[model samples]
Target: MITPAGTTAVGVDVGTTGVKAVLLDEAGRVVADAAEEYPARYVEPDGAEQDPEDWWAATARCVNAVLARARVRPADVCGVGISSQAPSVVVVDRAGSPVRPALLWLDRRGRRACEDRADVTGRVLATTGNRLDAYFAAPKLAWLLAAEPAVGQTGAGVLMANGYVVSRLTGVRSCDTGHAGLTLLADLDTGAWSEQLVDLWGIPRGWLPQVEQPTTVVGRVTAEAARATGLLSGTPVVAGLVDGAAASLEAGLVQHGDVCEMTGQSTVVNAAFEASRLRRDELGTMSVLPYPVPGHHLVYGSMVSTGGILRWFRDEFGDRERQLAGLDGDVFAALDELAGTAPLGSRGLVLLPYFLGERSPVWDPAARGALVGLSMASRRADVVRAILEGTAYGLAHNLEELGRLGLAPRVLRSVGGGARGRTWNQIKADVTGLPVETPEDARGAPVGAALVAAAGVGLIDDLAATVRTRQGVVRRVLPDADRHAAYQRYYSVYRELYPALRRTYDALATLRAELAP
Candidate 1:
């Protein structure tokens, strides 16, 4: 139980599928935490979206629940920080209500916009340090501007998930620099939005929210927000970061060469590196974004389906296990235990984890998931174990891409829901041939947001120094040499399957699109 005497800060993360909030004490301990889930609407075959109001509502519930569970005085909460999945974006009206559901990162509808505006590709890539892909905010924003009838240019403002929530909390619109860097609009070198790119999108300067450093205090919680969220009316609210960057901080990414793997519904592998040291051309494959700490950056590769695949399998196949876990109990533990019994390589079964297309290295928006080497003898355990191995193989593939660029991280510090799966973590360790370390608090981004709040309110000096001090690597899974060798051989086969089946994936997408009622 949290005692009232000590000062506490609140951290909130509005993730793609849920919101998690943590009560963090001054010493960097997560005293209490709460989470609430909301769903994303699969708009069509290749589209995924969520109501911005759901994000705010889920965030409010989580914050209030955390405070209530801790029984802490609202005044004792020194500050609040927030993080969210990005560069997912939503347009809002003057009253801060969503014009439509947010275009989540999983949405692939922006591919049409990207193809239509190919002329700006070169400048966009150079300016943003990322490709003009459907997976990013600008293309999605452009698509929405053209497709969303309610999103009028005169009244709508583009905001990332966190920006919308920040507006509701403080009645002030703000975008964190960390998210801005990936919008395909921000000039990475200048650390600000590129007017040229925004002009290319035909979006007015006024339509974009002002971007601030993640630790900068943008505003105080308004009385109205206080009533809704249980925060002090005047509590400081910092401009928060992308969830991946925040998770990096929680994983103890303090310096250049430090790496973190945020293994949530999706997986984002980040390797911290000084921008000055690496040239743009050298890091072309992955999305490069400014790290939460100013003057720092990370090269990130996002795998769209990692833990989500397991969740999909559990929802579709693990019915008995799910029922046995009961209400509010995790079915993943039982699923993991079942998968653990399967041998390494899952008896030659391989899975393509591109259920939502893919990003980083592959960059194929039409790519779909597949299961290979399946025979009549295949068991449910093999399929479950294969899912874990498949994600690990994808991570290995990403590491190989990083290896090409000379940033194969030595020790991967992991944080997220998937990092808790012993079977999955072990598979990641063995497949990547890197020791996988997980922090004590698996609720990473929220704690990282709390640290950001603590930093904004002067509770800590030097975000990097504070992160270094609060370093917590509770468990480390090292690779088994024999299993690693066997997996590498299987991974080579996994690599071949994608290229061989690339044409079929496109054909499948076309057929599915045509047949949809």
Candidate 2:
């Protein structure tokens, strides 16, 4: 129900691979939605970059499309919300023009900065409640400052992906707590930037953007932006959230121990908790961030390259499925259906879904993807099934880490594009031995953003109250005891595979470096 009735909100997500826009009405139903895919530039094997301008262009196109399809005038839309991939380093000059391509969340160029701070890992852990990883913004910001130098242009700005787009749309530069915590800049305890951490990185303190609460309406759409995108010139726009937090909110993770896993480019299993009740290192394998919801914190066990692995497989090996797929066909579902005939346990096959190395629990950038137990009799279906089961193992690996911390979830809510895969969802359930609930519409973050927008502009009273009353629209997948029990053997092997091949991964890394021209 709309608090005032008859109002709508628009939400946009600036994702790593695409831009998605959704128009939602009062009943929490999507009136219209559209998406546009954009590619990331991989100039170096370990480096990833993207033109921030491309994100804005795509976003404007999507917003216009969404508005046109919904047939809603700009004046009637209540507010606008945006969420984006977290902790990316997007440097802009005084004018907010792109100084260089944004260093994406996937970029590993800052790993050296992490290694450079090896002596202070404990301090960083204490300060940010998170280990130093290249995935965070501050380290990459340091790399950009040093490597590009222009990023340090006295009045230049450093922001995340969402902040950059938001600035383009509303001319406000701000970040929320979720992305702030990962920056290795925000003191998780104080919920603000720490001077010590800034000194630790030798970063100029002035470059960081202001941090605000997720639902704070930071600005209104400017006339310039309204012309570029089909938004009202004065529509309210909130500070927005990191995609994971928004996805978690949309998945019904309202209470403590409400576990949810977002299966997108990566699979991050999140569990909420009270920050005061937990010690700094209690979540060592995961990072703790201040939740968008008040008085709560989120622990994230991020598994790198989960869904990306499936996309890679689809592009490289699923030619038949793609060819047979009709208009707007979902290649993932088609591929999963092909695997239906494959035996459970994939007939003694194992796949390590670490094609782009790994994160969380392992923290091994040199880790390699591997397929074992293949034979002449092995078919494409077996390999596809192995891929699904392998990603499930990764998810289970994360759940195991959470379990050790006394935050084991009773059930897992799957959210994001990858959560729509029935075979994959079931496989994850069986492997993790947890009941999984997949939403009828797995695209989550955008909706959460819209909900936050509704709350920010006073269209809804009490955000938590509205979510607590969210309609129960989900497809529950229960784990079969037999399947869960039988998957234990392969799960054990998956756990051991990485350690056994560590030396090989190291050797391969050395050889690749040596062979580089």
Candidate 3:
């Protein structure tokens, strides 16, 4: 193995549900890792918030654990890199104290505002290749400014999770292009904050963090941050990409002709091109990021829920799995086995996996999950299989929408826990009619963050070169033509269910609200 010179760095991922610090060598080998979970508080159905303090505390705990487990001198770790859920709207006072809970990416409280402000959708997208969806920070910031009077009146707005972390570490607020692009704030052409959008959203541009390149060294660890986390003062911190973008780089999909499907709490598809391939509406949005090389851009579309649908099932139906597990089989394995036995299309059972509304294609939060075609003969296996296949069909739907933009990916690089399930991987391949590839190192986002740190400190020349040299391809799952044919029929039905039942879903939401505690 060709080892990198003076190899050790920590990549911290501030995710939706947790914060993890992965320690790696410059060659991208994992040394030690630590993670801490924090709550994503949902005060109401559409609301999501987290304390910036929780993130800093979790980050500190995870980093210290990594260092202790690795038993290496702090000096040996040359640099640090960060990756996080993007486009959060956080407010902090002058002393770097959070004025209010950070409104997270999962937050949908701003959807109404986004829908009402037509100018944000078109004007922002024209410059940034994005939409005025609640997923971005602009509308969330507006919601925050209106909801929290004190924070709005006196504090500055930080663009994302990493920006809050940066301010804590350096006592200066900052964000990078990948994160800024998600905020509906950055001008895709100029790579600067959009003044017109800022004015329209009623956000003061000064409240926005200073923008930097993904690899730009922001600042050293301040003494306060150093004490909280066992790190050497003056350590270089790289401006990191958003979690999905970093994961794409780790999966070796940075060059044109490569596509990455990051399946986590949500599913995101990012494709690299020589230049921007701008498209609007039905196809989704475009955004710019610093490529492993200069002057390259990444285009992507995102869905609000994917594996999350499975997680919902696992948590809700865990008792079913547990009952089976008592018989000496692993729960997920048993569920996989049962789902495998069910027919490709789940015996006429079709599911729309939009438990938390929808993202991508429809971009409607009011959308709800539906299980159509139930019968007296239906079994648990059929229900489980329908859920799995339904999520795959949703992915296929996203692909079809991307087709409107004229992007036909030859193959998709799959990352995260979803890729580990053999049956799930095959379902995606067959449903999407595209081969799915996995990386040898499966924990992608963290690995990508570490590689960026290595590149940041000169251990590697750039991210793409680092990924190609270090990351290995595991295997490819080819689409089953026969399975594809069957799914095509079922998918046609699945597509219609959402439109046919949208009004019913809306009514159900109102009823649930009326019955809530």
Q: lDDT for every model?
A: 0.85, 0.84, 0.76
Give TM per candidate: 0.96, 0.96, 0.91
Best by lDDT: 1
lDDT by residue (tens digit), candidate 3, 1-517:
1222356988888887678788887668889988776777776567788888888889888889999999987778777888888766678877778887888887888876787797445676677777778878888888877777777767855657877776677676788878887777678666688887778888877787778887777877888888888888877777877888778877787567577788777787777755554443433544445454455677676777777777667668768787878865556666767788888777789998887777776777777788888999888888888877988888887777566667788887898657777788898899889998887657767777777778877877767777776656577999989988988888899888888998898888777667766
In candidate 2, which residue pairs get closer than 3 Å at backbone N, Cα or C atoms, i.e. clash? none
Please write out the lDDT profile of model 1 over residues 179-217, one tens digit for every residue.
898788888887788888888876768888888988888
How would you encode candidate 2's per-residue C-alpha lDDT over 242-294 as one tens digit per residue? 88888887887777788999987788898877766778877768878888777
lDDT of 3 at 99: 82
Location of the lowest summed lDDT over 10 successive residues in candidate 1 = 1-10
Residue 87's lDDT in candidate 3: 65
Angstrom error of the Cα, residue 56, model 2: value is: 1.1
Q: Which should have the higher lDDT, number 2 or number 3?
A: 2
lDDT of model 2, residue 203:
79
